[model samples]
Target: MHGLFRWSSKWWPGLIPFAILWVLAAWVSTVPLEAELAANSGTALKSTVLDKTQISVAGRDVSFAALAFSEEGRRSAVASVEAAPGVRLVNDGTRLVAEAKPFVWVAERDNVRVTLWGTAPLPASKARIVEAARAALNGTEVVDRMGLARGAPARFDAATLLLLDQVAKLKDGKIIVQDTAISLAGMARELGGREAIAAALKNLPEGFSVAANDVKAPPYVFQANKDPVAVTLTLSGYVPDNNVHAALVATAGRKFANEKIVDNLKASIGAPSGFSAAVTSALGALSRLSTGTLIVSDREVKLSGDALYEAAAGQIRAGLAKELPTGWTTKPEVSVKPAASPVDSTVCRQLFAQNLAKGRIRFETNSASINADSAGLLDRLIEIAMRCPTTAVEIVGHTDGDGDAGFNQILSEKRAQAVQDYLVKAGLPADRFSTTGYGSSQPIAGNETDEGKLQNRRIEFLVRQ
Candidate 1:
């Protein structure tokens, strides 16, 4: 028995390895079934153990990795387990795990709420947001937290009437907003009658309020008027208001007297007391901007200069009955002239050229982009080049020799072509313009000084003449 014990101890070391292999085979056979495991074993596989770590991928409780064998003798043992529907062979506890996600997150979760912010589509931005949310939900019942905001209801002013066709009433210093019923609650400056004050607020959106009037008034007659055709209004007194566009026309006509006549009429006003007349005159000045004159018609008025700006006249017209003043008894004389375009040099230089002078190329700092300040000047040059009939111009580009000659030559050539491209895009004849680069070879100015270097980095225009 002692000899037997010694022999068993000696053999235990060798037997322990086989025992571990057997245990591994048994454990592997119990793995979940999968198709990948089936390919490795003679039969389908059951499950996978990923890298012997917590990170893993498996088909339910069974994925294709159960057919792994620790020894040749155990191959059949693993195969038997792998023969199930979804099984494959693998090494002992060795596997791969996916490392990345492939989808984008639309919301925190399926039932999460969404709220959007931006310019609303005028009337239906709220409804549109709801509809978009419904589409995303795919018929699942979910609460909609989505809504719309229009940058904040714009600040109410005489100009606010132009944006909102409806206006609120300021009555007895109180705010009132009802359909077709409007009022104003402050001392009427230049206001000839109470009805005239109500008429101006008609163009405002359905809300009204009177802020404290702290603006001082002039002691002389002031006048202003608005022109829809030219989309411009003029001011002639100490009226603090500027840009008294079409929106303020009807009600404003009340504070000052406007001739029902088409002829240009003028007048001066008298002051009542304590600058009240001056204040009225200042507010009255805004009325002259209308199509007809708002003659002082004999009153103590004030005067001062007011500011002006371009405004949306259409919005103003929409606020009132164009032919009828909703709250006033005055008539706005309609003009037959068409609206005029605002004057600027952009269109002129694009289509017509008066002449070209001081045409020079301003280079980008160590680069090729034309400076912003130079765009207008360059536009003028292109315009003049267009006037030469049946002519082609060679646009030559040059560079100072600061870098590699070959590179500089290439850059210079590209710069010329860029100019040519711009001209053609600006409606010039592409066929009439040719680009060439001379690198540092053709320097019109010395390259030693910074100012002279700028002159060298230029485009020269030569006509066939």
Candidate 2:
């Protein structure tokens, strides 16, 4: 029994050391496997398609158990794990995230009809969108062609409703939604419509994003009509802002001095490139017409009027297109007025009075300088003066009772000389016009009101036999 005990004690010590070494080796091998499983699992979770994943590792072999919304996602997760160091085998245990299709929708608007198509995540969402469309486009027809899909992106209902709101603002366009991606393309009904839609997109829910936005602004329209009998010019249209509105009004006033201006301009956004330049060129052409209408729609200009002569008509028709901005079109329908019979000096005098009675020549504010607005009236006067080249006439200037009498007299005289200079430059004989000035002493109207003051300031062409 003692001998058996001694053998057992010696063997026990050796066996203990061997057992400790085996356990240490097992632990060392398991550490790598555990570390590999943790790393691969972390990589799989970061994938957009992978919703959930379970990773198991056995001696360089990896089994990837993942829940993915798509087959592509499952394959991606597996591929990622397989590329990891020390991985040998991948057992794909991936399942689809949902059994149904993804949600998609499209809303199209044309003229007076709104059409809704594609798929909705829920029946309630489909009904809600249709109802919203009907309400937004009160008199227009709303057609729904949406189907049900099980898998929808987060906040799908809110995104669709927002898109529908934008659809109502468009004159004609389409909005599309596929999962979290949204697209809009079409023409806006009013200025700033495109900007408004883009601004609204900023409020889209998390996980939603804009794919494409191709919305466009409607064309800007400008209209002007000149009446010879009434001697008035009426302007109506939309300007980009108040600055542009003021500038356009001032331009019209300067270009048509003889004609009273009735401004009906409104301020808006979305003026096309070179809108102000285009309007200015059109007004310059309109001043040459006896009666005319100018319409500027977008980059297209249409002018129709009666010109003073055939040469003038041809010049305007041929030259307007060249004067416009690039990519601009001009359509001129100018007809020359029939030539009048030659008249004797007495008849010429009467004709001058008759035409001058309709409108007056204008001057710069508080100066003898001629206003650009007076050019059209002066042109008509020149036409009459040319008809009777030999006739002697006195160009008399008068002023309102507003300034120093001496200053007014000098201003009036300088103004008469300015008129003489303009006529001579226009090919009229300088000696035929004798100049004179009568200051505020010869006021034609009371100076108590602005209208009275304007009437009092005048120029008279008197015949000298």
Candidate 3:
């Protein structure tokens, strides 16, 4: 009996190796089956709207877990797993995603950053919206504060994307979307930005409509700087349109006739009411200054400069406000220039010669009336005449040889008398001035060309020592 027991134990050890081999072979076969089932289950859920999707296979059984956007989606996801090839069973751990009522979303911008908030329908939808905002902002910081939810209306993603575009145009503002309706409130970053956003809303996807649009445009501004040293009047900033732009330039030409006009004005939308009238009146005040600057922002006009004299300064302060359009206001920073010291007749004569060399007194064509463009030069002459208070002056007039000699002589004499009348009216005594006309007989320049004719038709000042 002992010898039989020893032989049986040896045979049982050999059977242990065969049993281990059989178990190993079974595990290897089940591994491939589980993998195949998991792959097919995921493939089945590809068409479903689900978040945090997961699938696990133990042999032929699939454990499915996901948050679904709708009740139908939840049921379909589990059914799809069960129907996958080689999947024998499905353990569903799916729930419907949180539903939002009258789903609302917003994008807001401030000077520092742009923020996006509210509910998103799906994980993919949330990702796409954030990506779109980042792309639109062009490096501006974007803060996302969104939560996942269901119950988004049809084309919710499309509506949200379009609203984000409008948000980009705001300097500081917000845009909101509730279902298929949108509302916007903010200040536009540029002159026409508000209108651009309103225009863009017209092309919203079908079934979408605007609820309220309160976007406001930035200030409409125009500016001019008169530089006495540079001898230039530079115009800059916005104009309402091309017609207004041309009119403003023409007015400047008449007002600042001696200064070079540098036009930097741009045509844009959104000018204040009575913008042209306010600007025109303000420019007139600026023209009376020795050097000045004018800024017209909305309906407010600001003029700052040194006036030619104290009486002129007082007149500007009292008169500018009255000249502006209704509802327009003016702030004038006017001061009188310092008066010049009296000089001898020789020095005065040299000053007169220098002033006339720069610009001549102009008269209307075929008439004795002085042109408006000569006002600036005339003022300079008056100032120089004031410096030589005791000196007697001879005012002489000449004309081009384009007309009959007799008519030219009469016109020239009348023009010299007009100068004497102007000086007499400006508080200068009449006895200190004498008038004469040489007509075309004293021909210092030939009248053959326009340039020579311009030189020939001039007024000369002779300071008597």
Candidate 4:
């Protein structure tokens, strides 16, 4: 037994060195395999289709498990790991990612409501889109009808977010995203909405392209009302910008010398092709009218009111149509003011009575201020007074019994004086007219009823002998 032990001890020392050498050799061989596996695993994970990679190395052998969405991706991962340095064997446990159909999405907006539909790449992407849409469309309803899908185009989230921005600019429209191709259609809220969308689409990420764009713009409306009695012209509605607005105001000032301009224009995009030309021509027509309103709605021009004379009415109707731009339509509803005929003092008194019988002069409530409704009647009276230049006339005012006698007398006197002043301004001689007031002493009708009181208030023209 001692002899066996002695032999064993010498061999055991030798075996110890061999065992150490074997362990060292095995460890040395595994270092390069481990390094190659790590390098190849990194490369595989960086691929567009590969995910969730795990790698193990045993000597010269490498084993990897990863998820791939396509057959090409699996083949690519296997080839990449096989090419690693000092790798003799590769074990691929790669499984194909779940298959999914192509993704499609649509966002539609009508006035204040926005609706989203179709597939989203992930739960996070869907939530992000809904939140962004809500923010973009303020004071609007946003509805989502989206489902999750495994495959999405490159920069899908970014492309959809950009489309949502475009949707906000539309008055009513729909944006469709089918895989990488996008289409937009509907009415644009502004004139530049379509152009703005095109510009934005240019910045979209790669693999995204516009399939179709069909957007319509709203009509541009410009309106003006000329009041000759008030000596004012009111401009309201949309103008392209401040420069255009200022130019229009300046033009109105130059054309109508006696008119005071009131500008109530707002800035907006999308002026029609011949907006300025149409507006300028309409203003020219309006200047010929004694009182008129001009409305320019896109390519349509509408003018209505009284012309100074019959000849002027016919000339304006014929000339304005020829002056308008191509593709423009003009509608003029003009009536000529009748010229006063020459008459003697007796005939003049009879005409005055007939004219006053048609409509009485109107005064402001509780004041001597002449109301606008009396302008036409006053104009007719002035014309008649001017025709009989040598005849002296008296404008006598009367009132109903609604107020105190003294107050009514004062109001009537002031009102007669107001009429006299207006006629003088209309080019009649101030010395040829005289004014008086009778108050409620001469009522032609009963003062107990509103209609009777309205009839009782009058201004009589008495021819001076």
Backbone clash count, each prediction separately: 59, 0, 0, 0
> On residues 1-465, what C-alpha lDDT tens digit does candidate 3 reach at each position?
999998887787777889999899887888888888888998999998898888888878889989998898899888888888988889889988888888888898999899888889988889999999998888899999988898888888888888788888899998888887889999999899999999999988888899999999987889999999999999999999999999999988877767899999999999988998888878878877888899888788899998866656786788789988899888999887788798999999999998788777878898889865565566667778888999999999999999899988988888998888877765678999999998887777889999999899889999986
Over 129-220, each residue of candidate 2 has an lDDT whose tens digit, in order, gives: 89988888777899998766558887888888888889988999999887898988999988789899999999998899999999988878
Candidate 1 regions with alpha-carbon error over 4 angstroms: 1-357
lDDT of 1: 0.40
TM-score of each candidate structure, all chains considered together:
0.27, 0.64, 0.74, 0.51
Best by lDDT: 3
lDDT of candidate 3 at residue 427, scale 0 to 100:
61
Better of 2 and 3 by TM-score: 3
Sorting all predicted structures by TM-score, with the top scorer first, yields 3, 2, 4, 1
Colliding residue pairs in candidate 4 = none
Q: Kindly indicate the candidate among 1 and 4 with the higher TM-score.
A: 4
lDDT of 4 by residue, 40-68 (tens): 65765564455566888877677888776
Candidate 2, 380: how far from true, in Å?
A: 3.1
Overall lDDT per candidate, in order of appearance = 0.40, 0.82, 0.86, 0.82
Among all windows of 10 consecutive residues in model 2, the one with the lowest summed lDDT is 44-53
Q: Is candidate 3 or candidate 4 better by lDDT?
A: 3
